[model samples]
Target: METAQYDITWTTPMCIMTLRYIGLVMDVYDGQKPKDKVKPEMMKTAIPNPPGFLEIAAYGYFFAGTFVGPQFSLSRFRSFVNGEYLENGEVRQSSIMVSIRRFVAGVVYCVFNQWGAVWIPDSFFNSQEFFNLPFVWKIIWNTLWFRATMYRYAMAWCITVCLFLINILWLILACF
Candidate 1:
C-alpha cells in the first residue's frame, strides 16, 4: 500500500516534468528546427543558459497548479523565477472581493446541483418510464443533466482562481 501511494505521488509530477522538459527541448535545440523555419517569437533574444535539472525539478514540484493547471510555458516560468515577470514595475493587485465572489458562486452552483440531483433518479434513464416519456419531457431531462453536471466545471474554475488569489496575496505581503 505504501508503494502504491509512493508511485501515485511521484508519477504525476514526473509526467508534468516530462512535458515541461519536452517544451524546453523543442524550443532550445537548434537541430530540431532549421533557421528559416523558426518563428520570430521562437528566436531567443539573448541566449540564456538552459535551466539545470534541480531548477527544473523545483519548478515542476512548485505545488501551485500542479494538479489542475493553467500550464505556463518554459520561458514564462524562467521569467517568473528570474524576477522579470513585470518589466514596467507595476504590480497588479488581486482583488479579494473577486475571489470571494467566485467562491460564493461556486458554492451556489454546488448546492443547486446537489439539490436538483435528488429529484433525478439514478436509474431513471434506463427505466421504461424514461423511454415512454414524450419528446418535450426528454428534452427537459437532457437539460437537467446538463445543469446538474455543470458544478464540476464551475468548481474547477473556482479552485484555480482561488489558487491565483492566494499567490497574489502572498506576493503582495512578501513585497511589503
Candidate 2:
C-alpha cells in the first residue's frame, strides 16, 4: 500500500512529459513546424496537472481506449493501432458496439470514483495535531493523498473509455 501511494503520487509529472513528447511528434507528423520550434504551451493541453488529471484522463479514451481498449484482452486497442485491423478496410456494427461499451464502462468507473471521493475528506488529516497520535496516522497526509489519487485514477480511466467510444462513433458515422 505504501508503495502504491508513492507510485501514483508521481503520475502527474509522467503524464505531462508524455503529452509533451507526443504533441511534439504529432506536430511534426502533421507537417507543422519542427518540434524545436513548437512552444511547450501549445502541447501542454495533452498532459494536464494533477488536479486537472480528469481532463487528460479522458484522452485515454482516444489514444489508449479507442486505439487499444480495456478488458485489455480485446485486441482492438492493439490491432487498430498497428494498422492490421484496417487491412480489410471495413467498419462494421460490431466496432461501434465496442466503442459504446468502453464509454459505458467509463461511466461505471466515474460513479464509483465520485462516491468514494465524498466518503473521504481531508478532515481525516486534522487528527495530526494531537500530541500522541495513533500509529495509523503515521502517514495520514499520505493516506489522504492516496484516496484522492484513487479517485483521480478512476475518473481518468472512465473518461478515457468514454472518449474512445466517442471517437469510434464518429468514425462509424463517417464510414457511412
Candidate 3:
C-alpha cells in the first residue's frame, strides 16, 4: 500500500512530461518539413516548438499544476516563456475575483475531503470485523468509502485548477 501511494504520486508528473516530449517530437517533425509538403491531417495534430529545452523542462516540472493538472499546450507554454501572453494583458477584475474564488473553494474542498476520509476509516471495511456489522451498516460503509474516494479525486482536481489559475494570474502580474 505504501509503495502504491508512492508510485501514484509520480504518475501525474511523468504523464505530463511524456505528453510534452511527444509534442516536442511532432513539433520538431513539422518544423523540419516544408510547409507546402505538409498534409492537412498532419497539421491537425502538430504543435509548435516550445521556447527551448529549459522552458520545456520548467513547464514539465512546474509545481503549480504538475502533480494534478489542467495541462496547457506546448504553444501556450512557449507564449508564456516569451512573454507574448502578457502582451495583450487585460487583467479583468471579475476574472481575478473568479480565480481567487476558485483557489479558496479548492482549499475548502481539500479540507472537507480530508475530514471525510478520516471520519470514515477504510480499514473498517476491509477488516474481518466489518462482516459482523448489520446489513444496513455494511451498505452504509460501502457507500461512504465510495464517496470518500471520489472526494479525494475531486479535491485533487480542484486544487490543480486553482493553482493553475493562480499561476496564470501571477504570470500576468509579473510580466506587467
lDDT of each: 0.66, 0.51, 0.67
lDDT score, candidate 2, position 140? 73
Q: Rank the candidates by TM-score, best first.
A: 1, 3, 2
lDDT for each residue of candidate 3 in 1-176, tens digit (9 for 90 to 100): 34522234656677867776676677668756877878886665455442576876786777654676556656666666676765367444335666677767767776776776687766667787898899999998888767766766676776666676777777667776
RMSD after CA superposition, every candidate: 5.8, 11.8, 4.7
lDDT (10s digit) by residue, model 2, range 1-176: 34522344445545654654455345334334454655775443322212134533444434643332332211232345555766477555445566567667667666665565565544545555532666676567457656654755666666666675666767667877
Q: Could you say which candidate leads in lDDT?
A: 3
Question: Which residue ranges in model 2 land beyond 4 Å of their true spot?
Answer: 1-18, 21-82, 85-92, 128-133, 136-148
Taking all chains together, the TM-score of candidate 2 against the true structure is 0.43
**Clash count for each candidate, listed in order shown:** 0, 4, 0
Please give, for residues 72-128, the per-residue lDDT of candidate 1 as tens digits. 666677677666866586666655777788778778777776776577744677789
C-alpha TM-score for every candidate: 0.64, 0.43, 0.62
Query: Which predicted model would earn the best TM-score?
Result: 1
